[model samples]
Target: MKIIDAHHHTWDLSVFPYSWMNNPHPTGDISHLKNNYLIDDLLEDAKNLELIKSVHIQCQGGINSPVEETEWLQSLSDKQGFPHALVVYSDFLREGIEKEIEEHCQFKNTRGMRYLLNYINNDPINCFAPKEALLDTTFKKNYSLLEKYNLSFDMHLWWTQYSYAFDLIKSHPNILNIINHAGTPRKRDEEYLSNWRNGLKTLAQAPNTVIKISGLGMFDQQWTTDSIKPLVLDCIEIFGINRCFFSTNFPVDKKYSSYEKVWNSYFDITKDFSIDEKEKLFFKNAEKYYRI
Candidate 1:
């Protein structure tokens, strides 16, 4: 039951700005995410059973000093020997994005960059960026530079932006686009889900894109295995086993359940899957794409 967490975060509020952890959260109380979460906290939460490796997605850092997060994580990895790779933040809207990418790549573990593109008309407060931020010419040109760095793109966008996401992904077939948080399903209504499934199915049309079946707790805060099983299975079905992988989205998702509980529930939901399929979901696919 070896596992490689495809998406998660480790942060220290005292060391970095982590400016978002203090803001008002859209999904109700996020008091659980305000504190620093370090490597020991992660291993203890996971019960250290089979978490062989992990990839640390960027938690927002000082807006101007985003690469500082990567340097910090690299130092932590040097000391703790986990968080096998790094996905640091990059603000494409700003100047010197190439310098930011170069600064990040100087760290040995740097693997990718995550510039969230989540925007909804109704949820204006929580939108990470404004409308069509993904399509902005500056952002697209900066994103295309990742091909030169041999880095992947950890895309954090909502279902409403899937069509926008596919447009960006289609132009950059050489770069892998890891869709974070199951396309960030913010609503569960029948109308919303019908649209979600259609967009998700369309995104899966891009071979360069893969889905991380995580962050289920954001919408289903009181979730149980039964509640999230369908979302997890639906992702696997739509993307096919080869392109889907599981993640804990820990400390952030800790608002919902313990790491032991989260991983066990993933195991429980996929109990009927073949050994090879289970391995792909749990570890191999993440390892292959993350280059861990």
Candidate 2:
């Protein structure tokens, strides 16, 4: 079956700084991926995995850089030819954000915006929700700008904060909210599983939300396909095949396993799903969700 990897990232360490890669965190088998993975690298991996297309997610490096990573991916799409869509990051908390959105929308491949809200600080996480910016009256007036520009919202918040995100989406159901990494559940302890599963169930109930089955390899260093299958299957059951999609979460997920191994693991887990459902989760759903 054809596959569309909906959540992957590429970066050139020589051009930008990736502080997270340099940290001495205990990232199982992916400790060697502290460098750039250009288009060539990704294409080769895709060819090996037989993937038809990919959506390039923005790494944290290209965040404040003048060379917006989405545009950079667009330039690559024009020249190198692989990415079906680009999920760029934008700090909605900034001023005159509409103008930035307008400029980003001009790119034919610009799929949506991803706001990283994984806060570990004792801060109230909901305080950073995009809706909070909308409450400013000025931002609220322009809240429809995303739909006006035909852009989706790719959320990268912690699994626990998904309820706040669900509430935000209820306010703007027109905006498609793609939940990255199945809310990125932590798998280190048994106690965390129940909370993660309950939170995922709640997020899947939002009709406008699409759950991405990616980043499983990174949730825990020793994660294997068998270990992650229950979570993956649960998401499919809750969201159904239509609202679910699969991704490589590459290079980032490489922190735990090889690209080939990650996709192979996913393939093994979904081996028993019906062909149509598998196609939707592997390709069609992403095509529809990203309008690729």
Per-model TM-score, in order, reads 0.96, 0.87
Tell me, by TM-score, which candidate is best.
1
Clash pairs of candidate 2? 30-255
Residue clash pairs of candidate 1: none
lDDT of 1 by residue, 1-292 (tens): 9988878888887887776766776687788777889998888877757889999998876545877778788888999888999998888777668977898999999998888787777677678786667878888889999999999998888787888889889988999999899888888888888888889999999999999999899888999999888788889989999999999888888988888888899999999999999999999999999998
Q: lDDT tens string, model 2, 200-250?
A: 788777788889988887766678888888888878887888999888788
The total of clashing pairs for model 2 equals 1
lDDT of each: 0.87, 0.75
Error of 2 at 168 (Å): 0.5
Worst 10 residues of 1 by lDDT: 60-69
- Residue 113, model 2: lDDT of 78
Per-residue lDDT value at 258 in model 1: 84
